[model samples]
Target chain A: MDKFTVHTGTGAPLRASNVDTDQIIPAEYLKRITRHGFEDGLFSAWRKDENFVLNKPEHQGVSVLVAGPDFGTGSSREHAVWALMDYGFKVVISSRFADIFRGNSGKQGLLTAVVDQSAVEQLWKIIEEAPETPVTVDLAEQIITAAGFTTKFEVDSYVRWRLMEGLDDIGLTLKHVDEIEAFEAKRPSFKPKTV
Target chain B: MGRTLAQKVWDDHVVRRAEGEPDLLYIDLHLTHEVTSPQAFDGLRAAGRSVRRTDLTIATEDHNVPTTDIDKPIADPISRAQIDALRVNTAEFGIENYELGNKEQGIVHIIAPQSGLTQPGMTIVCGDSHTSTHGAFGSIGMGIGTSEVEHVLATQTLPLNPFKTMAITVNGKLPAGVTSKDLILAIIAEIGTGGGQGYILEYRGEAIRALSMEGRMTMCNMSIEAGARAGMIAPDETTYEYVRGREHAPTGADWDAAVAYWKTLPSDADAVFDKEVIIDATKLSPFVTWGTNPGQGAPLSATVPSPDDFTDEVDKVATEKALAYMDLTAGMPIRDIKIDTVFIGSCTNGRIEDLRAAAEVLKGKKIADGMRMMVVPGSVRVRLEAMAEGLDKVFAEAGAEWREAGCSMCLGMNPDKLSPGERSASTSNRNFEGRQGPGGRTHLVSPAVAAATAIRGTLSSPADLVGSN
Candidate 1:
């Protein structure tokens, strides 16, 4: 995972609420074992239409997505975040994000910033008015500024810290390996064992 | 302050806590399926980490397994590789895997409870979202992502943050002919898809308590549809009776001790919640979704809602998009909608009781011509139990296809799927665009609804299909 802090890029406005993971990356493309290179499969179904937002020519090459409230609303697929990251999105700014999707994004160094609904509306309007407007998201300051429509976003301090430092979760958790083994040793025998 | 059932379970699971980090909450059980485990295992192997506790982990092949052609090799190479990868990975990791033809093989959610592995006061996590179904037993079941899957595999614990509690109290007696599926659909419609976000919703009040174990499972199963990561119900006599004497449940003195501990898991009378929502169950009726999302639903008698009905522009746009995707029109009666297929199985409603409910409606009725109705049990054990009672014969006589259990047609990972532009009245949760198949339309309903629709060739309730025999 890449370390993220103060990324500047053009924003793509996809103002769809409750845009589920199925819509993000359909179930058919989930068969592969390799974790990366899902860019083509991202919104594969929606991309068929000539007028879909991401398929529109001007929106191409944008690395930041400004979606509506309650984005990434269904499924526990980390592939959704992978698709976004693989497609060159460093941040997904929304009014609200599904819990699992947000957690998954945190692990992949993809920033999911929760701003107020009005702030999201502001960004969407600005991007719609000028497709090439530069958007800057600063994790340390908890603020997003695009076309002078600046808003402070809220993120968990721990997640913010990890994103800024480019931490690998599995590696971090491994530091507590002794504590994990200790917990396993105390587990009751009645619990069903896979072995 | 007294703790809610979720709080009590979460508080008890804390093995170690630190001032600056999330709680190191121990996991009692971890479940795996074909699609999600391979990557996590790869990550583990890449990092040279073995599973911290193989005893707490279990795996099954569901998503990619062919339900109809169990004897033949999987024709889809991608799916075949997924199943094979799961088998090899489990064998290498020292994990127990229930394979396709095994009697215990089925949907991970269903097999866990049916085999008594799902117990009260336990904290369960799975790679799939529907794992929330186990919350019916008073456990804290969470749907986790693959990175978290790797985390649990390594640590047997999650660095977790606490969630706010919401008491969704459904009071008053549910009218007859209304199933738990109807109750949950109505709740989602009332609260919208994002209502339960960031909170653990506990189903409480008179109506929730009166539901059977199967009913509670169906209710908790869709908690994800309402945007809640986990859902809970207090442990009671009904819960106790269901967990007793199952294959993995405790025996003799162990049984007594387990029950004693479970009895203490319900919320105290004065326990507080972060929010409260009340529903009068008597007002609910058989429900179905008319749009692409679970929140776009109405009673069986209600018509497709107009975009004009929504006050928010965002909601109106979503409704318009959904209406276009579903090929529905405003003011059209929900029951008048035609369906190409009726899918009567998934982790949501493929248990024995779900089968029995659909069987009662299917006993003497022939399915309408040109309608494709298929019943897939949640697990092979559920199929065996249903056959022992001759329900399979009744289904066959009624023209509904009976097949081996898996998540057949739920997400369309297997051979069972609707062709493009096909619409179905399905018992599974989620009606998202292309959820069943690419461009396949879905209407979420209960088993009874699925059976009646299959028999009538349209969206229907049992009341609409009377005298079909």
Candidate 2:
């Protein structure tokens, strides 16, 4: 995990609500056991279209993703977040995100910024008119700005800290090793009854 | 002041809490599968940790297992290794596993509930996301990661943060042809898949109360689709009736005591939820997904939304992109969207009841020309029951392929896969791009709709086929 500082990059907006993990990285691409190089699988079906946003020349190297309400719904596959990271998406801006997907993203050091629907619509309009319009997402300020409007967003304090430090869930859990050890020591030798 | 079911479960499970520290919560049931458990078990071995509570842990093989030829060796080398690893790991760790061909072997979610391992007031965890399916028994179930899987394996406890709760109440009676599947699809469409984030949803009201155990299971199975950690229906007489006389269910005096405890699991009338949503069941119809996400769905009678109709510029772009991938023209009637394949099985709708429902529709009818149809049961037990009822023959006579049981085309983890550019009407939960296979397009529908679509070779409701019978 690295220090939590906001990095800004812009792309041609590819906004869709409830963009599930299956769409992020389809099941076929998940054949391998290893969790590396899923960037190629990110939106693989959509990427086939020559005119898709990712294929647009101007959106190249963009790290910020502006999306609609209820983003990242369905399937708790962490590969979705991994794909986004491998494809250079650092922050996802949406009105809301699926709980498990957001948690999975947070665990992987990807930032999810929940903004108001109106602000999201504004950003979409700006991005639609200017495909390469720059959108600034500030982790420190918990705000997203594009065009002439700026909107404050919310992120859990603990998750914010983790993202700032680029810490994953395992990294966060390992931070309290002494506490965990003490708790483990108190466990009974006998296995608990199955519910 | 209203506490949702998720809040109740989370509060009950909290063992200890300290400032800036996660609570150490006991896990009641831990379900494992071949795909994710192998790595976690390896991690446990490297750390010299034995499974702390073998009784609480259970494993099954589904993702990589083939639907055909149960006795033959797995042809896929990687899949074989995964299954083999699960077997070896479970044996070495003294954990219980229901391997293929075993009567208990099934999709973990289905087997857990069917065997009474999933019960009210329990906290269930699995490496698979649809573990929420257990919540239909009023349990708090969640999907966990591999690292967390190892944590549970080593300690039988999960570090947790609390979640808020939401109550989604569906009132009034569902009209004929509207199934529990339709209701869930409608809910997902309204909430846009992320509606229940950070909340466990408690489904209530007359409509939910009327559902059978299998129906309730199907509703909860897709809780993950709406970003919910779990979806619960309170344990009642209906639940008790469903669990009675099961192979593992409590018997004699213990059954009475269990029923008493289960009765107490429901929320009080005054219970408060952090958020609330109300849906009118009468308005829902046989729903189907039109786009890549489950939320991007419409009633079977509706037409695909034109991108130009979207006022939000971002929505327009998304609509356009979805149309392009789906190869569907905007404003076209959804019923007119032709499909090449029809699949009826998965944890979502692969039970004996689901097979019977599809069989009822396909009994005397034949599949339309150019339609490729397959019926895969969720478990071996389901397959056997379907066969006993002659539902397999019904499907076969209707021009559908009847095969063995497993998670077949739902996620395409095995030999069952969709060819490139193939479009399918699937009873499975997901409709994401290539979820059926590479370049495969999926239209999510209920079993009834899937059967009808198989006959018509396009999207159609069961009502459309009822007249023909």
Candidate 3:
């Protein structure tokens, strides 16, 4: 994980409510052992359509994904978040996010911002009208700004800190190695120990 | 401020809680499968770490294991390697394993509950999302990633934050034809699949109380669909009755004490939730997904909404895209959507009761031409029970394929798959694009509906096929 604040860049509006993990990275691509190099697999099924927003040439370098409510629903596959990050998406703006996906994304340092439905609609309209429109999502301020519209979102303080520091769950846990070791030493006789 | 089931389980499992730190929660049971365990095992090996509590951990081969020819080597090289890797890892780590063809071998979620390994007020973790199914026993169960799997493997504990509780109380009596599947489907559609996010949902009220253990399992199995970490029903007489006499359940005096503890698992009458959703079961009908997401569903009698009918522009575009991908015409009755395949098994509804229900619908009617139907049991024990009851013969006589137990067409992880452009009516939880197979359009339905669809070669309720003989 890299330490860098996320901001919406070259936003290409593609709004689909209840966009499921299966659509993010189909189960076919899940066969691979390595988590790396899923960029090509992101939205592979939908990218076949020439008219799809993601297939457009101008949106190639876009980092912001403006989506509808209930984004990332179905299947608690962390691969969905990985594919998005691997595909260079820094921030996903939606009215709401699936619980597991939201937690998984936050852990992976992917900024998942939940704004009011009206703000989502506004962003959707602006990005749809002007393809490659850029929206600034300042994690430090917890605000998303685009085209004279601004929205504030809330995230867990610990998750926000982890995202800002680019620390994964493992990294966060490793930070307390000494404490973990101390706790391990206090374990009861019947309790098992890691080698 | 009464405790919800999740809080009760969480509090009981919390070994320690310090300032600015999460709880060091002890896990009572850890289940592993082939799909996600390989990487975790590799991580442990890379770190030269051994499993902390082999007695508490159990491994099973599913997801990638074939439902046919248990003796033969898997044809898919990648899947074969994954299964082999799990066996090697479990053997090296001294963890108990129930491999393919073993009576204990089955869908991990189904086997855990049936074996009485999933007890009330326990904390369970698995590398698979449907682990929430264990919550039906009043346990706090949720899925974890490979790294977390490794963490639990090495430490026998999981660091976690607290979750808010949501009570989805389904009141009133469910109509005669409406099953637990219908109730859950209706809830998913109503909540738009993200309604339970960040909340542990407790299923309460009359409708949930009336459900059998298998039905409760089905209800909790799809909690992930609503973005809930887990869904639970408090233990009662029904839960105790289901657990009694099970192979691993407590015996004699221990059983009495266990039941006593289980009886106190329910939320107090004054308990308040962060969110509450009241559903009237009578209003719900047999439901089916018409689009690529479970939330994009309607009652069996309703028509697929046209893009023009959507108030939001994004919704309109999504409706159009889903319609195009599904090759469905707007405003057409959902029942008129023709399906080439009908699948009635998955962790969601693939149990003994589900098999019996499908068998009742397909007792004598032959499958219509061009319709391929399969009845795959969730576990080997379920298969044996179905055979003993002669339900397998009924399915075979009705022109349906009776497959061995595994997560068979719910996901095309193994040999079961749909060819490109094939559409299916499935009882599985998801309806995403290509969920069944490449270019395979899936419509989530109930077992009875899947059986009826096989007979009619289109979406039809079981009531429609009734008396047709």
Clashes of each: 0, 5, 0
Q: Where does candidate 1 stray beyond 4 Å?
A: A181-190
In model 3, the Cα lDDT at residue B277 comes to 93
Model 1 chain A lDDT-worst window of ten: A186-195
Task: Give the better candidate number (1 or 3) by TM-score.
Answer: 1
Q: Best by DockQ, which number?
A: 1
Residue-by-residue lDDT tens digits, candidate 2, B1-469: 5455565666666655777756767677899988767667877777676787798799999888988898999998878877888898889998888898898788888888777777777789997889888888888889876657877787667777777778889999999989988899999888756677787889999999999989998999988888888888898888888877776677777777677766767887778888889999988889999987787889999999998977967567777877888999988999999999999999899888888889988888999998999999888888888889999889989999998778999996799999878999999998877788887888999999999999987799878875664
- Span of 10 residues, lowest total lDDT, candidate 3 chain B: B13-22
True contacts kept of each: 0.64, 0.39, 0.33
| Superior by DockQ: candidate 2 or candidate 3 | 3
Query: Against the hidden reference, what TM-scores do the models get?
Result: 0.98, 0.88, 0.92
After the best TM-score superposition of candidate 1, give how far the Cα of residue B174 lies from its true spot, in angstroms.
0.9
**In angstroms, how far off is B312's CA in candidate 3?**
4.3
Find the candidate with the highest lDDT and give its number: 1
Per-model RMSD to reference? 1.2, 3.8, 3.3
Model 2's alpha-carbon lDDT is 0.81
lDDT digits (tens) for residues A84-167 of candidate 1:
999999999998899989989998899999998988888989998899999999999999998777899999888888888988
lDDT of 3 by residue, B1-469 (tens): 7877778888877766787666777787899888767767877788787887787798888787777787888998988877888888899999888888898888999988898878888789887778999989899989876667877888778777888999999999999888998889899888867778888999999999999999999999988888897899998888888988877787877787777777788887777789999999888889999987777889999999899988967668878988998999988998889899999888999999999989988887899987899888999899999999999999989889988888988887888988889999999988888888879999988898888889988899888886775
Q: What are the TM values for chain B, all candidates? A: 0.99, 0.97, 0.98
Pairs with backbone N, CA or C atoms under 3 Å apart (clashes), candidate 2: A1-A166, A4-A164, B2-B272, B2-B273, B3-B272
